[model samples]
Target chain A: MRSDKQSRTPMGLKIAAGLGLAFLHLPLLLIFLYAFTTEDKSYQFPPPGLTLKWFAVTWNRPDVWEALGLSVRVASISTVVALVLGTLCAAAVSQTRFFGRETISLLVILPIALPGIITGISLRSAFNLAEIPFSFWTIVLGHATFCVVVVYNNAVARFRRVSGSLIEASMDLGADGFQTFRHVILPNIGTALLAGGMLAFALSFDEVIVTTFTAGQQATLPIWMLEELVRPRQRPVTNVVAMVVVLVTFLPILAAYYLTRDGDQISGQGK
Target chain B: MPHAVTFQKVSRHFGSVRAVDAVDLEVEAGEFFAMLGPSGSGKTTCLRLIAGFEQPTSGHIEIFGETAEGVPPYRRNVNTVFQDYALFPHLNVADNVAYGQMIRGVGKAERLRDAEAALEMVKLPGYGARKPGELSGGQRQRVALARALVNKPKVLLLDEPLGALDLKLREQMQEELKTLQKALGITFVFVTHDQGEALSMADRIAVFNHGKIMQTGTPEEIYRRPKTRFVADFVGSSNVLSPAFTRRLGGPAEWASLRPEDIRIGAEGGHEARVTGSSFLGNATRLTLDMAGEKLTVLLPAGSAVPAPGASVRFSWEPSALHLMGTET
Candidate 1:
């Protein structure tokens, strides 16, 4: 029956899918094309010359390396913190029936759903009111706020998929609470946790808006790119850094997809 | 034998819904006991209470003569095979079976040895390396059994263990489990909605309904003489007839219950009735007759000529074959 419908798919749908793919990738392709162009400041379609000079220049820059290292450190630290906090929050909220549970879940998810600018401004204001020094820790804290939402969502979904009977069976087999969680619950949700952590790291790696507010003078890679784009010297190298950002972010997204691919098929019982 | 597990007037209520209401039961040591009921009849809740998954709202539960009021499931000397066979999907069969011993701080070598032995007991010796998802339903179920039984608990609880299997596999597993129980001589408390399963495996069957045990007796005693209408309907197919006035045959509140096989269709001094329907059942042809504004079904031996629909027939059975039940409502 599905094959019958597939054979009759409308021409409009095929064209729509084609146009949608082009709309999504055309900007990224243009960015890649401009990264190799010889032009210094202009954003023109057909460049006069293509050169590998800017790629070399972007590779040797010490500031670029520093920002890259900082971004990696911040993203990794934030991902780990988010994973722990998010998994704990997901487990707590998923298993218990308590007053204000729905409200707490809503508050936990609100940070990601709100506009990034709003979260940035709110964090900035909170930091100002508390007289806290803005540094690497602040940037990590800013990124972790939104990263927790990603990990929380994935972990909660995985926890919900886990059958309650499995926990009961583990306990019945003479396993204590911690042992049941280790042997039964952790293995079932491990993939989801990994997927969520990868996505969160990717999101934090190139995040500009929230990082801009939290990182006072500390230049993350995205901040460095923003500074390079505004200045006039060797502007094509900014595009080169942008291309690097795309690659850095793209691999994790792919990894996340692969990690979560089998999770979707785990629901229905196989014959 | 002393009771291995006892529920002393235990009750559990989920808000207003009384899942297990003020119940008392005793499972004897080394006996295969079954709790039989329909869905939502609290049989599983009773099993959970005994397993320490759910604490009773009111009264106490005792396991092996010890009060189980504050004991957790892991500390209790009982293991359960859940209905869905909740085997860990990530762990191989050996690791899954070894989990309990590992938690108890058993050495790695000892744990592996015991897990392999348990796997062998379930007749899946080489299946220790396979994931639960890689195994068939029956194989997964056996792995779950191994996982639970490897702990060697004093009592084993099975909650509708064969519910997920097909008819043939369920029957086969029933005999295998009964044999395993007898060989181990551990107290087995099995819960199932299938009366045939309970009757075939259990040394004593407890028929539960509406959060209460309607009757508890041996399979033959419960099937041959049901004390209540609910027990009669649930245990097996019965042609419940409302006698105009039943005379007490023996003990107080005892009335006759006519088994379909025992009620002969063309016997001497039988009541006359019109045949309403007939069903061919290989060994016997079940005939439904309308007698005194009530439908009565009788089983006639195969190869016997079946009367046409609306045809008059006579049915009778010996008085000794009639089971004595408690007073009808």
Candidate 2:
């Protein structure tokens, strides 16, 4: 049926789809092209020459490495924390019923639903009011607030799909609660968690607004790139870093899509 | 020996809805006991109670003479083949069958071998490495059986295990399951709404209605002599004669049940009835009759002349065939 529809798709719709793709990717294409341009200070079409020199300059910058290390660490720690908290929250909210269960889930997801600036300001004020020092941990905490929503969304969907009978069968077969989780529940929800965690990682790695409010003295990779765009430093180096950022963020999203694309293929699903 | 499972006035209530109300039951060891009822009649709830999945709201339960209140399903000496054959979606057949042993800390190789033997017992010997999704419905049902049977529990609870299979496959599994139960001598508590299945497979049957057991007896007893109108109407299609109809038949003015097969057509001194409908049932011809303003059904043996819809006929049964029933409980 999908093939039948694809075969009959109007020519206008096909061209419109192509245009949509180009509109989304054209800026990234420009970033790629300018990363190799020889010009240093100004934007120009059809550069006089392209060189690998900017790539080398961007590679040798110690500030680049420091910011890159900080961003990776923050995203990594935030994703880990999100996976644990998000999966637990998803399990509780989907698998049981109690007073305020729906409200608790909504609050869990509210951080992502609100604008990033709102979450950033709230975190900053919360830290100030508590007299907690702003450092690497503060940025991680801010990123975790939203990262958990991503994992919770994915894990909750998968949790709801796992049949209640499967859990009962496990208990009937002599599995304790912990053993049932390890053998039955974990394998069923494993892919969803992985996909959710990868998405959380990508979102955290490129985050800017929350990090701007949470960071006191440290600069993440995105913050570094934002500052470089305003300054008069070698321009192609900024484009070079943009290329790295695109690759770092794009790969996990791609991997996440592949992991969950056939999510409905779990055994005994419809049976 | 103590009964395989005993329930003394067990009642499971959910928010004022009595799912199982004041039910007393005893399942003998090594006998195939069936709980037969329509959907929401509490047969499945009773099975869950014995499996320790649902604790009774009141009264006591025992498994092989041991008190069973507050014990979790994992601690019980019973396993259930769920209605949908709830095989783990992530595991292959061998691992699924081995899950019970694995939880007991049995070595991997030994459990796998035992799983294979259990699969063999279910007549699905080698098809263990494949995932359940790859197998057909009947095969998944067998895999579920193997998974539950590998543990060698004292009681095996089957919750409409063959309900998903086609008619031909259901009949085939029914034969295989009855033989397997007798061979293993494990107490089998089978729950199903199909009266034919319960009659053929169970050594004793408990008929349920409105969250209570209407009758508990051997197949012959339940079929030959039902105690209430609900049991008579449910166990098999019977003509529930009103008190007026009973008096017209020269019996006391009380509710009575007469089996359709027991009524013989074209009998001398039989009550006159008009044939309202007739249908061929392969081995027997079912004739619907309107006798004295009450509906009656009679089975004519194959090769007998079936009366037309407007034809008038007379049918009668021996006095012993008319089983008197008590008031509705």
Q: Report the number of the highest-DockQ candidate.
A: 2
Tens digit of per-residue lDDT, candidate 2, span B106-179: 99999999999999999899988888888899999999999998899999999998888999999999999999
- Tell me, by lDDT, which candidate is best: 2
Error of 2 at B77 (Å): 2.2
Tell me, by TM-score, which candidate is best. 2
The segments of candidate 2 whose C-alpha lies over 4 angstroms from its true place after superposition are A1-26, A29-62, A97-108, A125-133, A234-237, A250-258, A261-271, B327-329
Where does the lowest 10-residue lDDT sum fall in candidate 2 chain A? A262-271
For residues A1-271, write the lDDT of model 2, one tens digit per residue: 5965767877798899999999999988999999999888888898879999998999899999999999999999999999999999999999889899999999999999899999999899999999999999999999999999999999999899788899999999888899999998988888899999998998998899999999999999999999988887698988998888888677877877876765556633434
- Candidate 1 chain B least-lDDT 10 residues: B243-252
For candidate 1, the lDDT comes to 0.86
C-alpha lDDT of residue B149 in model 1: 90
Interface RMSD of 1: 2.8
TM-score of each: 0.84, 0.90
Cα lDDT for residue A130, candidate 1:
100
